[model samples]
Target: MCVISGTHGVEGFCGSGAQIALLEDAAVIAAVEKYGVAVMFYHALNPYGFSYCARTNEDNIDLNRNFRDFSRPLPVNAAYREVHDFMVPSTWPPTPENEARIGAYLSTRGEAALQAAVSGGQCDCADGLFYGGAAPAWSNGVFRDMLRRHAASRRRFAWIDFHTGLGPYGHAEKIHSGPNDAAMIARARAWYGIDVTSFHDGSSTSAVLTGVNYEAPLEECPGVECTGIALEYGTLSLLETLQALRGDAWLRNHPDADAKTRAAIKRRCRDAFYCDADDWKAMVYDQARDACLQAITQLAAAPVPH
Candidate 1:
């Protein structure tokens, strides 16, 4: 079993904290070991983004979107293209006119459409939102390598990657990421309960994403039966989260901004992805522990392959 947190840089702190909390819990560690599950924790996959409070890596690439088969044609986001200029204007906070233009697009296209356009991983417009890089990113290579080294020998593997910013406050959405076959879906439901969702069916709070990190195992360890889920916990409203993302993009573009602006942007980003309440943290830990335990139990029950 493997758990990954902080795959998106700034959006990862809550996940990172949850990972640490799980490791420190004696009961969780004992339970995992008793099930004969080897648990691997990947904290802060994009260290540069984690440290700088930025969503992208040092190359301004969205680490989550950077995992793609570069040999093929990259995915396109025509909807994002329509609003690209408005989303990241030259000015910080955007001028009133630019903001109005964005508001108009959102009003016209509706929220889901806007989300698909902006958040659905774009290969074009590297300077724009959710840009998937032209080549595999550093984190992409590292993650693939980690899977090859640690997961190749395992007959059955289960991964729970932690994320935030796309659901009701403190609610954890278990999103399955591998084959959408009935058996696979049933297995996920049996392990994580019926609350599990799939992007293929548009049941997830998240739009259908490309180049997601969970695909790494399928490429690196083809023989293993890999079942992966992204436990996306929510903190802020969808619109608020998008605003924070745009604010961070603006900050990235304008690095020479004043301290006040930077601090405010960072605070918004944090609040958008993390709820700084004791109850919220408790929910994160509870859900993470439950998911990990469930995965381990399921993996232990499965027959080991020769």
Candidate 2:
């Protein structure tokens, strides 16, 4: 299964290009056919955001952050409320005073606070960026439905999710999924080696992530052996990307702002997660192809887990 990040269209230069390359690779296609592994590619899971160049979907929900069980009281990030207004200010191209306020807040609050306040998914505001929906998202529902239908026939399933804007340019990090299940970790190590990092260890760039994308299959597809990896590629540094996102959020919130200001904000957001140059595209594609091929080979060789 292909789980690609940055499917939010603007980040397409990262994993989107790589995903297409893998799909086109002659050897990769042959391997899939040989192993009888069905390919499920989730393209632009956040189509609205991708098409509009925003990280959050039309609902302003980060697809990755929207996977919580709606039945439960959603996870709350209290710190976000304080900076929500600052992120999506009422006026476009935030007034110099507003910018100074945000700078001062960041200075006093620290970078960690800024990251947490911005990245920590929220449920209270629909217009706020990175809002983790109060209920299951459209993409979330679609993915679960697909798993229910296809997972029943497959005994072994492996997933590689594509992502960007972490690490050095073109560098890929393998972040393991779910709890540190020993057998699962062993299987992943056997395929990708010792570099596999986890959220529990604080090594992964991904915040302590949750949702059904990884956990749901483990629970629902008890009959199938599943292991997943989020292949995060490097584009730009975190601080720069954060600034870009902040700028984008500000512009999105302030629609009445000048066209020039909005255009610049949108451009910054696009550049933060994607590398538009052909050389960078080639590099990301090559690495992604290698990783997917390795997974396919390992799956073909390993004995079916009982």
Task: Give the candidate number with the greatest TM-score.
Answer: 1
Off by over 4 Å in 1: none
Q: Give the lowest summed-lDDT range of ten residues in model 2.
A: 1-10
Query: Across residues 23-99, which tens digit of lDDT does each residue of candidate 2 receive?
Result: 77899899889976667776776677788788777666777777777898877777778887777766655688877
Per-residue alpha-carbon lDDT of candidate 1 for residues 110-183, written as tens digits (9 for 90 to 100): 88988888889898887778888999998999998999899988899888888888998898999997755677
* Superposed Cα deviation of residue 121, candidate 2 (Å): 1.8
Q: What clash pairs does model 2 have?
A: 3-161, 4-162, 5-162, 9-50
Off by over 4 Å in 2: 3-7, 105-109, 180-182, 256-258
Model 2 vs. true fold: TM: 0.88
- The TM-score of candidate 1 is 0.96
lDDT of model 1 at residue 90?
83
Scored by lDDT, the top model is 1
